[model samples]
Target: MRKAPLASLATVGVIATEDVHSNTSVQQALASSRSLRSVTAPALITPRSDGRARATRTANFVSGQTAFAPTGVRLAFSYARQSEEFPDGIRRQHEENARVAAGLGFAIPDTPEFRYSDDETSGRLKSRDAFNRMLDRIASESKPASALFIRERSRIGRWNDPRRHDYYAVYFADRGVPIVESCDPQWVDWDNDTSDEVTLRFLHSTLKSIQSRNERIEIVKRTNRGTRAHIKQGFYSLKAPYYATDRWVAWAHTREPILKLDPGVSYVREGCAIILRWATDGSVQVVRDIFGWILGGRSLGWIAAELTRKCVPPPGARYNTARVDGPWHKELVRKIARNPIYRGDLLYGRTSQRFRGQEAVLAPQAQNDAFGKILYLDFLSDPPLSRGDFEAVQERLEANLYQHEARSRTKRNYPLSGVLVCASCRRGLHGFGSAPNRVGQVRTYYRHSMTRGEGSQCPHENRYIAAAPVDSALVNIVHDALASDRLQQLVASEVTRYLDDPRQRRRAEERHACASEIRELERELGRLSEELGQCTQSHWERSLRSRKDRIVSKLEALEAVGATLAQEDARLAAIERGLAHQEAYSATLYTLYGQAPTLVQRRVHEGLIEAVHVDFASRQVLFTTRSSTLGAEACGD
Candidate 1:
């Protein structure tokens, strides 16, 4: 909001590398000239003696209206919303901090972090992307950060778990990086574990956590209560209609469910009662037919196939076209047969969130109650089927549910789910087809599915190859790469790391000693053989033969020891390489995928390789990255 010259305060030599939220290029930044302490940079700092090589605490921390922090101190701000719609408050707070940092001659490298966050996100979530990055930076030895700046402790986090709050504040500060929230009065230096300070910080953290949780709970409860109130007035807010587009007609209301402070003025309630009768619609006809078929001893699959043959659109097709596929799945048929909407009751508040993003499941009692699960008292519309008929259909459906589950469980599963994609359309290739049960042979291929149930098929041509061929091809590629000279170079560059780690370094040294001893024994055995050849005298020949046998036996034992040591040597080399590329890449291909099982190999390919595109018409497969389209090859071989 305001610009100020940064030549006034002389304190910290802060370098905002990239974004505060970024966890990349940390090791390079530690070794590179981009750090604030480098002579090439405008800032300068004398490193402290307490293990950390930058930012001493002797700098002027506070001066009247402005606060000038030491070199390598970072500020983290959690934005609060004044209005749910507009998040101008957090932006203004962040800008104000930057302006202050700028005027103090400190760098607050504006990396456009959280430039467009407010609309899509809220502060309640513990897993803030930027917050995680800040924590990662603080924890890193390569990225030397001495202190974290926050507007308030609650701004940093407001988890229901008090342990999480204390861990961030006390544990991190004890390790050297203290959280500084200048605006909040309750902020305590939890690093100084005094009875008074500990009590204050703990109490403050607990209260803030509890208050935030209670507020969120209240909001959810109020929303649910309002929805239920509306449902009672004949307009169902949660459950969808079975045969009709909307079960309760939305535009009918009996009375307002609120009390006005100004005698008789308040917002009017939306709807009152549902008078519409479900006589005959496509959805109604399907449900009626499904129940008839189930009673007549036809399977759910048979009913679904009959519906598909008749070209009838499945229920919820008008609402969600993407989810409704080419053929009717039995699950859809079961949902229609079991819906309470067909019997005129409107369901509300029947489910609660166990965890975020999970489909809210029915309460334990509701789920356990096989025959008496209908709990909602609100009757919104006239019944299509009698309650007795609905109960009978449900009883038969439940009796047959186990058989459906057994068939699904007995079906074969392919391991390469996450690996390949259609090169042309970039759609994932699904594995279909299975060998005969008694064939005793595995035969499956990953192909782009064009069937009705699979989400969006490729508009252009698609290609897929046999899974066995790709499995063989990938293993060969990985083995060759591991044996290449590139692997040796990677091992060499990371050897200097973890030098101070005495225990682990000692383990590496022992492996090295074992290799040296093996070489020395081999040289001794060579010399002994020459001595045995030179023994021409009959008296010396017997003694020489016995001595040579002893040497040969000892040499065999040493060689076996060296073989075991080789495995340890490889593991140690991998540890060194693992430290360097832990964030960027994975372990060596030999250790990871070369000797891995099919499931593990497929998972690695899915998680690592960004995309696999295939085209059947052109008979080509293309391997592409997250950013670009790369090499292409024919599908035949």
Candidate 2:
């Protein structure tokens, strides 16, 4: 057996720490050692114990030769945010970053592989194309980068949360690569041995993060103030004007029209103010017709369908190229009907977008004329609708929403509305009433809802069974089953089995768990309320109140769930009680069922029968209960 060279093993370990080119000696040693023939090449190359020492040795090893070295590579990332006020922002940022990199004695390669940039992007957002690419490149490389250069600390992120802002820096530092802020005075490398220098760097980064957040908040405040001022002066500031309205530029002081702006046209001029005016197009007539149709008792769906049929362009069609010819939706029609702008009144500040999230929260609309009134409009031209008509339309819309007018409409009665099913296709049969004959008698029949369609085909597609016979047959079957002792025993056994089921037991346990959670939340809420009431500090009070509010909301949701579970338990209990005392309950139900009116009979059928499946060819009806089925002969027409 040939002995392995100990000197070669030590050389292999040292060379592996620097680069993989030193693997030739290790291969030679492995070839010589008979016992080490089965050992893999990676087994001889283990990571160094000291990370700082390894990084230094690797850097020296790469610098001594001409081969490419990842440890010597310094990747630079630049970000630029663009807006209407700063159109040349991206170009300026690139120039400034180049200057900063030169001042720090680091040369950023002009090539795309060495340099990354996110143009026309906000640092507040997490998703950036070039930023993610740079991170992936560093992660996938066998030898990590020595440093990542940026213009300043804020270039990493101006995140609202400090934790998120520090996450990227920590990620690079953990990989033995330090982020170098060229503009930062106290910039320190990742391999810095002094604790004081590292602490100072961390403090500087934290302060920069805080400063960035404050700067963002200040910018938002200034923008909001300017927007409110502009709105108060009666300039259109929110978004595109409503349908049938055109945005026009007018002299600010004189209130004289300078020019009519076409749809989607936007420009900023020194002495000009933007205002909304009635459009001269045929769209005005369309808006008027919509109001008139709503007042004339036309449903929203019907109005949308009619507009779509006429190929009328809906609101926002001018801007949305894809949906220009799209069908009008009922909700769009409803919005048009609800807007107060058509009534010669401007409404703003109804909702507010928070700085932290994209969703808008409800804010009270401005009541005073400062922000709500239109200064340019004199109401000289005709409004979309008269004041009285507008109020009437609003009233009609409100009534429709609350379903108060639904009671006024005539309703047809169908006793077997959902109980009747076709055996052929296993689909529910709908009741259809025919016109009265000369004898003044109307015939009701139950037929498959879809006689011929894409779904399963029914053998008796054209066949229709008279509703009166089927209803009578179902009633007789239910009555007979209620009187039978065998059915009572079957129902009792099934109900007991269902009640004793593991799933049912789990449901009960879940209800108890929900109740326990609710109780715990209630106690927490009470404690928080007490703390909020006694707290002297404003910040502490605010925090306690927020906790209390969250707990209260959770309790309300749990209580709602508990109520639903209680209802289910009550329903099961009623079934158990009825089946337990079957003799008395059956007698009462059988007597009252025959004399019940259509509505009452419909309720009885839904409660007693799961489904009434009819086979027209065999002239047989199958009555399916909760746990069993009973068969009966069909009544003749």
Candidate 3:
């Protein structure tokens, strides 16, 4: 729904300065009713020749008409400096622009004549000369029609951008003032949903900025080209006359004698370049050795002092500063190693102009002009330093990068503890803290399944393997397999048999899948049972009691099947071991017959050993292997 515009509206003259221009919108619409007036405040401030301000105490009288509505008309004034037409580089003329903007504000709605306040400072708002006076009228007792008027939006906030025009618009509109643009004098409605219009305006604003910036850029380029052309023609084209500046000197040259140019700057630059070239060619090693010596034990100041004592020329024969007089100072080192111009290259225009004075005045010498007299100006490139020399310096500066990596490893408490991988899953092993055994003699180990992420993806989520039993057993097995010929033969035969089997392999895969599913289901059932026990409803709870019984039965069946397979696997493993160690089997048979062997051993017999799954709780180990060959039996434990 369209909002109804305010009916009883008043027009107040406003004086908007550059800072305010940025924060206000120029084009806007207001409800034009009979209550709305074309004129605003009458000029209360009269300009004086003594550079002092004078305000007339005369009470504003509305005498002319009483026909169109009954209320007496309120008079006001709007004043603002709108200077969007001036280019950004023309800093000196901003005062003139402000005066022109003020004059235009006075011309409109002539009843309240405005005095141009050209005393505004650039890059600042709120403290502007013209804006402060207008604010006073808006704050008066009569609350006269108030709003600062400007020629355009940008002029008020010339240095800073407005956050949102609507905020400022509503701010003054609520106080009975509305900013009106001279180009398009209308009250701005900030809440208007005009995306396309705003987009077009933004684009126009961007293009204008671009055009202004490009103009400055082109002027600089032209100036440079012209200077180079004059140099090539054997003519000196210094901006300031040589005689006028204390820094300038005139001298004549003999060899390839060209033209009039400042010899002092050129001589210093060429000498610096020669030194740089020499350093690049063969003196790079010397520089690095010097840097290392400084980094190792000597202070930069000490190095500089030593160099000065040795009568070494510093930075192209330029006298070393006191800091560089004794030891190799930082400045001297940087100049010798870091200066790009020494490598026969020239860099220019690295900084932009910024107003330094209180009034924001532009200085003429904003750009770099130090390197202007070389004979081969065309040959110069940015950082004309050689890449090889620069890289050498960088290498020396960063020599400790890998040294720190090694240091960190040595400092770690358990460097290689967690880096081991599981032979079966290939996942990284997890580490538990090391502790002393109950005997306080041997070290005991703790183990947990290595895991990553959350839930099943985490290796430890399935089951945690204890370190104590597995570490002891694995060590025993490795020792036995290596030292005992019987054990080695047994392992080799079993491994080879498992690799040859196909049906055994398929059965093993199916068993693993079933085991995983059953484990998951058991977890779910346990969770559900716990939840059911917590419920309040007795009837629903009783019904769940029957369902729990059925779930238990199903779980029991799965456990039974898993147990059968485990037993069968054990018997086959003993037979394989017996066959491998035929000579030793007679002596070991009696002990094995008393108890069921672990599943890992049984699978080892059937030659289906793929992986060993250890259960930390029961000290039981299950072997995942091929399921092809089933009819094997173990002699004993």
Q: Could you tell me every candidate's TM-score relative to the true structure?
A: 0.40, 0.48, 0.26
Per-residue CA lDDT of candidate 3, range 1-637, in tens?
A: 1222342232222221111132333222222335434433232343457654433211111122111122433333445353222333233333333343243232223433333333323323546665666556555555444334554544444333343344455566566556554454433233432434445644654554455445545555676775555344333443322111112222323123223333133322221111111223223444554555644654344455555555444443323255332333456664454433344332232122331222311122222232233332222223323566655554554444344344444422221123333434545445444223355332323343433212233333323444555544443433333344554455567766874578666766766876886897788788779979798999888877877787788888877777776775676676556565655643353245224344434433334333445433344644343333222221100
Please estimate how well model 2 matches the true structure, expressed as its whole-model Cα lDDT: 0.62
- The local lDDT score (0 to 100) that residue 148 gets in candidate 1 is 49
Candidate 1 lDDT, tens digit per residue, 458-516? 56423356777655555554444444445445544556545345866676677678678
Please list the C-alpha lDDT of all candidates, in the order they appear.
0.50, 0.62, 0.41
Q: How close is candidate 2 to the true structure, as a TM-score?
A: 0.48
| RMSD, one per candidate, in order | 19.8, 21.0, 23.0
Full ranking by TM-score: 2, 1, 3
What candidate 1 gets wrong by more than 4 Å, as runs, is: 1-112, 115-160, 167-199, 216-337, 349-374, 383-389, 405-552, 555-637
Candidate 2: pairs in clash? none
Better of 2 and 3 by lDDT: 2
Per-residue lDDT of model 2, residues 1-637, tens digit only:
1222223221111111222333333323223233222222222233345432211111111121111335433334443344233566656656676566444333455666656777645677777888788778666545333446666666666667866667877786555444655454123333422445456766877888899888766666676666656665667764477888888889999868888886656668999888788887788898889999998988787688778767788786877877766778788888888876777755454323332334222223322322222223332256777778888999999977755343224255667766777777777877776654566466777866542212444667646777787767676767776777766677678888988889987889999999999889888887887777789999888888777778788889999999999999998888777765778867886888778888787776665667678787786667666444343333333
